[model samples]
Target: MINIVYVESSLELVPSEIIRHPSVRRNAKRKGKPPEENLLDRSLHHWAMDRLDNSEKRGRPDIIHFLLLEALGSPLNKTGELRIWIHTVQDLCIYVNPEARLPRDYNRFKSLIEQLYVDGRSPPNGDTILLELRKININQLRDSLNPDFVIGLTSRGEPSSFETLSKSLCDFNNPMVCIGAFPHGPYQKETASIMNKQINVYPEPLEAWIVNSRLIYELEKCLNVYNSQKIL
Candidate 1:
C-alpha cells in the first residue's frame, strides 16, 4: 500500500488567544457553537488570525478538505492501495479510514472535524472507526509507518514527473509521500527531517489537491488499477 501524509496541515480549533475576537465570536454564534469549538478558518477568522503566529500559513482546513475529497473518491483509494493521514500544524495526527465517506459540504466537514477534536474519534462510541485523532507529531507518525521510503513533495526539491516518481515508488514494498497542505510556507523542521528524498513533481508550484490528483492517477496507472481502460 502507498501512504499519503499531508504534513503540517492548517487544521485546528480556534486558539484561545483569538477565540474572543469579534470575527471568531460572530462565526461561532452563527454556528451555534462555542468559539473554541469551531475550526480555525481563514475565511471566517482572518481578522482574528492576524495576531496569531505564522498567520500566512495557518487556518486553512479547506486545503485538507479539497485534498481528502479528491483522494478518497479516487480509484487508488477504492482499490485499497492508498492510506492517508493528516498531520496538522498543531501536531495532531488524523487517521482516515479508506471506508470513511467524508462530508462533501465544507461546513459539514468542518463540523465533523471539530467533533473529532472533542471526542477523539467520530461516532465516539462505535466499534468501527471512520476517523480518529491522536496527539502525535509528524516525526512519530513517520517512525510508526516505517515505510521503505519517505518522499517529500516540495517546490524546492529535485524536479521530476509523476510517472517517473511512481515508477521509483513501485520498487519499494511501501512508500509514503508527504505533501505540504498549508497555503504557504515550507515544511516544518521536524517534518523535513523525515524525508528519505524530496521531489518536485512540477516546475511551478501547484495546489495540494492538484498534486494529489496527478500523483494518484500516475500511481494508479503504475499499479494497473485502470488496466482495462485507455489512459490517453
Candidate 2:
C-alpha cells in the first residue's frame, strides 16, 4: 500500500519558481510568459526533493506529493490561533491498480479545464453539473471505490473541500473527522469548539505537527475498520 500525504493549499497560490526543468522554461518562452520566480514554489520544490532523497536512502519509491491549498495566507503568527485547520484543501496520493481506469465522469471535469486552456472556451455551467452530482448522495460513492478510509477536513460552517468527499460517503458511516480551524485574516477564532469526539485539533505550525503515536495507531485501526465494511 502507498502512503498518501495531502497538503492543504491551492493550485493558483503555488508559485511556478519550483519548476527546474528546461522543458518548462521552453514552454513558458513559447507561451510568451515570464519565467516563474516565486519563493513558495522554490520551497515546495525543495520540500519535495528532500522527501525524495530520504525515500531513496530507504530503498523505496519516493513519497508522492499532493498540495492542498487553503487560503493563500494564514500564518500562525499572523492569526495567533492554534487551530489545526482541517477543512481547507486536501492533496492525496493513493495507490491504485495500474490497469484500473478512472470513471468517465472524472474526465468530464478535466475536459472542462482543457477546453478553457486549449480552445479558449468557457467551462460548461459548472454549478449545474455539480448540483446534479450532489444529488447522487453517499451510497453511490461508497460503491464506486470502497476506499480504505475517508478523511474529512472542515472549517467553521460551510463544507470545506475535504467535506465534499465525506458528505458523499456518509452512507458508509465513514469516520468523519472535522477540525474547526480556519486560516488567518478574518475567520480565525479564539478557541475551537469541539462537537464530536472524533473531531480534534493540533498546535500551530499545523503542517509540521506530527501525528501523536497513540493517535496514529487509532487512525490505523479506523482505516482497517473502514476497509472491512461491506460496500453498498
Candidate 3:
C-alpha cells in the first residue's frame, strides 16, 4: 500500500493561550461549545490568531479538509492501495481509516474533528473506528509505517515530474509521500529531516489539494488502477 502523510497540517484545537480570546469565546458561544472545544479557525479567530507566531500559516483546518476529500475520494484509495495519515502542527498524528467517509460540509467536518479531539476517536462508541488521534510526531509516525521509501513534496526540492515519481514508487513494496498541509511556509525542520528524498512536481507552488489530485492520478496510472479501455 502507498501511504500519504500530510505533514505539519494546520489542524488543531484552540491553544490554551488563546482559547479565552474574545474571538474564540464568541465563536464558541455562538456554536454552543466551550472555547477549548472549538477548532482553531483563522476565518473566525483571525484577530486572536495574530498573536501567535507564524500566524499566517496556522489555523487552517480547511487545507486538511480539502486534501483529505481529494485523497479519500480517489480510485487509488478505493482499490485499497492507499493509506492516509495526518501529522498536525501540534505533533498529533491522526490515523484515517480507509473506509472513513468524511463529511462534505465544512461545518460538519470541523465538528467531527473537534469531536475526535475530545474522544480520541470518531464514532466514540462504535465497533469500527474511522479516525483515531495519537500523541506522536512525524518521525515516530515514519518509523511506525516502516515504508520502503519516504518522499517529501515541496517547492524547494529538486524538480521532477509526477509520472517519473510515480514510476519510481511503483517499484517499491510500500512507499510514502509527504505533502505539506499548511497554506504557507516550508516544512518544519523535524519533518524535513525524515524525508529519504525531496522533490518538486511543479515549478510554481500549487495548492495542497491540487498536488494530491495530480499525485494520486499519476499513481493510479502507474499502478494500473485506471486504464484507457476502462473509460471507453
Clashes of each: 0, 8, 0
Per-model RMSD to reference? 2.5, 15.2, 2.2
Candidate 1, after superposition: displacement of residue 21 in Å?
Answer: 0.6
Indicate the worst ten consecutive residues by lDDT in candidate 2: 59-68
Poorest 10 consecutive residues by lDDT, candidate 3 = 223-232
Q: Please write out the lDDT profile of model 1 over residues 106-134, one tens digit for every residue.
A: 98999999999999999699699999999
> Number of the top candidate by lDDT?
3
Q: Give the per-residue lDDT digits (tens) of candidate 2, residues 24-91.
A: 45544654544342111222243443433222212111111111112111121123211121122222
lDDT of 3 by residue, 209-229 (tens): 999999999999898987533
- Candidate order by decreasing lDDT: 3, 1, 2
RMSD of 3: 2.2
lDDT, candidates in the order shown? 0.91, 0.27, 0.92
